[model samples]
Target: MPIATIILAAGASTRLGGQPKQLLTHNGKTLIRQIADAALSLQSGPVIAILGSNYEQIQPELADLPLQVVLNPNWPEGMASSLKFGLKALIDEPVDAFLVVLTDQPYVTTDLLQELITTQQQTGRGIVACRYGEAGHLGVPALFDIRYGSEFMQLSGDIGARKLIKQYAGDCAEIPFPLAAIDLDTWQDVEAWSKRQGAGFEDQGTQPKS
Candidate 1:
């Protein structure tokens, strides 16, 4: 069974003061590029990027990379819209499982992604999420068995896969990832994380470009 990775890059970064965070150069590459690269390295299946907002600027960043780009017209609505668009686009592909990831978590490594895939395969669970504890800490970078494709397409509003996780808790597996919680939402967040990482704020190595 092949695993397909959907990089959710279609968010309106209103909190970031209207800047498209995916295009922010945390290092040499943009956040979206870094996340897409990591996802491609881990799984050999098709990798799709859901683009919205400043799609044109970010589209060029992913050029030459082995990825499929799907524009989400309803991206302005919410994150769930992008997920639905991406999943619907791949309905005919030979996808056995789907790994939905965000382009903002610079700390998410290919190793962690591979581990999630392995765990999902081993347990044959319906949903596998990276646990960040009780703030309803569920978001992208989640792997869902193909069995839940219908449910994925039904997602709406600002909701993510948490509802499915709760509904299918018995069939879900949690992979604890503390680093996954460190996402860049604002310039202050970037500065604080850089300070904590003991790296210079100007250094892009500490930040992931998606």
Candidate 2:
């Protein structure tokens, strides 16, 4: 099955004092590039990126990568807006299913994405989401069959793929990914994560984006 991918990188990073998380360095490459590479690593379909906020600066970081870039002018509206645009871009493509990804998740691996695809194919479910802790918040790095494309288009405001995951829970399959719970949303988050990995990020400044 041909699986397409959308990497959501349009957030303004308000929580990080205006620094674009997508440009943050990890494993020698920008976060955006890392996630984009992971998506394309699947080699199953086209990878599209939704860019907003500091797109000019962030674009260069991904200039050498192979993926479609779509600008979300309504990015201020929130995550759902970017998702809607990305889904619209893929509506005409030839794909069996599409995966929605986030750029700030440094731990999201190509392996996890492949698992989502594998589970979807094996279970024949339209949606395959990562199952985390007790809150049971199903989220991206998720794969959605083309059949549910319309539901994605209906999303609005700050909502994201999670909304649809819950709306159609009966048809979804879960993959345990506690690592998905670790996301870089704030300076403290980065600090804590960096310490956990002992990545020598202690001197990287405390201003979140710095």
Candidate 3:
């Protein structure tokens, strides 16, 4: 089945003192680009990057990648806006599923995503989500059957894709992804991540930390 991947890179990164988390880098690659590359690595289906907040700054990062771009003018409305906006763009397609991923999770790998799809297939479930970290947080990077399109549009302000994962708990499948918890949200987060990677970084703005 053809599955479309949506990279949720629209948030303003207000938590990082206005730093655009999508622009943050790891191992020399911008976070947004790295996530886009992971989705593309699957070659499973179309890849769409949702941009908002810092659309101008983040859009160019994916200019060289083969994927679709949809800008959510109401990104300030919250994650639901970007999530719904992306789904609307693909609503006309005959995609079997939609894979939603956030840009800040640097450790999201192709295998982690692939297992979500694989688990869904094997379990015959409508939703496949990542159960991450020690708490086994169930959330996106998630895959949802297209049958849930109307419910996705029903998602309102501030509520994210995870809401549906919880609302439809009966049909959900899970895969362990401990690294999903590692996301860049603050200068301290960046510092900690960089130290873990054994790398040095510049203060956040537009440049990738080296």
Candidate 4:
């Protein structure tokens, strides 16, 4: 089965005072660049990046990567629009599975992606998702069988793939990824993630106030 990756990088950084979260630096590289690099490195069919909001500004960052780029004009409608747009872009490709990933999850790696593919193939599940957090939240980076393409196309507004995963939980496989919960949503998140790399940042015993 040929698997393709769709990177959603269109969210407006409303919480970060208008800053582009995808442009935030982690370990010297911008978040989007980091995620794009990992996606491009995957042994998959095609890597497609969905850009919106600040598409022009983000375009240069990915100019050198080996991937297809698509713009989501209805990005203001939220994540679902980007998801639908990406799926539509890959309609003509011979893709058996699609992996939806977010650029803000700096910890997402080629290894973790490979794990999702491996689990999905081994268990023959139609959906494979990452499990995280103490409460065990299931989220991306997720892989879905082509059989779910129509379901994806039917999604609208702010709805995300998680809803689909929950609806079809019986046929889904999950891989635990505690760090997947650590995403860059605000300035505090950037600080915390930076601290992980030898920076002197105090954890303060609480999740960063989103």
Which regions of candidate 4 are displaced past 4 Å? 200-210
How many clashes (backbone atoms < 3 Å, residues ≥3 apart in a chain or on different chains) does model 4 have? 0
Question: Which ranking of candidates, highest TM-score first?
Answer: 2, 3, 4, 1
lDDT of 1: 0.81
Q: Which ten residues in a row have the lowest lDDT in candidate 2?
A: 200-209
Error of 3 at 37 (Å): 0.6
lDDT of 1 by residue, 81-147 (tens): 9889888878889988889889778888788889888888889887888888457575456889888
Candidates' C-alpha lDDT: 0.81, 0.86, 0.86, 0.86
Over 1-210, each residue of candidate 2 has an lDDT whose tens digit, in order, gives 789999999999888888887877755677888899899899999999999999898888777877889989999999989988898898779998899999888889899899999998899999999987578688887999988888878878999898898999999998989888888888888788888988843212324434
lDDT of 3 by residue, 84-121 (tens): 88888896777999899998888888988899889988
RMSD of each: 3.5, 2.1, 2.3, 4.4
Off by over 4 Å in 1: 133-139, 200-210
Give the lDDT of residue 40 in candidate 2: 88
TM-score of 3: 0.94
What does the lDDT read for residue 204 in candidate 4?
22
TM-score per candidate: 0.90, 0.94, 0.94, 0.92
